[model samples]
Target: MELSEMQALARRVRSKYAAMETARYGREWTDEEIMLGFLGDVGDLAKLVQGKAGVRPRDDLDEALAHELADCLWCVFTLADSYGVDLEAAFTSTMAELDGILAAEDTTT
Candidate 1:
């Protein structure tokens, strides 16, 4: 699926979670709080990445790494949607800029 499709799916999932949070805790999580949750997921993803790279030992490391990556993606998609970011365009532009920077550095060197 495309990034846009994934974004829509993430929004629906986020809405469901927000409703559940409101029902259970009487309030939905703020955007900042959601970002913090994303940070935690990032931390977990880092550990799983390390394990998958054989820098650390872990059982079911591959599966765990995949799950963590998806978790990180979900958080990013949700956060981007909340902030009105066009993530697909942003990603494309950012990568192109980075590529140009690297190309320039290579030419200079």
Candidate 2:
């Protein structure tokens, strides 16, 4: 699926989580809480990457890596939605800037 489709699914999932959290904790997670959760997922992804590198030694490493990556991506989409950021546009602009910088450096060298 495309980025927009993925983002739509993320928002739908977030809505479900919001309802669940409100029922359990009387409120859904705040933006900071979302960031913290993303951080935890990032940490998990790092360990899984190490396992992929054969330094951490995990069975079923491929599946774990895919899951963790998806978890991290979900957090990104959720955070972008919460913050009112156009993630696709931002990503494109950032990549374009990087490419320009690299091309400039190549000419200078």
Against the true structure, whose lDDT is highest?
2
**Candidate 1 accuracy as lDDT:** 0.90
Model 2: which ten-residue window has the lowest total lDDT?
A: 100-109
Residue 11's lDDT within candidate 1 is 92
Q: Find the number of clashing residue pairs for candidate 2.
A: 0
Q: Cα RMSD to native, each candidate?
A: 1.7, 1.4
lDDT of each: 0.90, 0.95
Worst 10 residues of 1 by lDDT: 48-57
Each candidate: how many clashes?
0, 0
lDDT of 2 by residue, 23-53 (tens): 9999999999999999999999999989988
Error of 2 at 64 (Å): 0.4
TM-scores of the candidates in the order shown: 0.91, 0.95
Please give the RMSD of candidate 2 to the true structure: 1.4
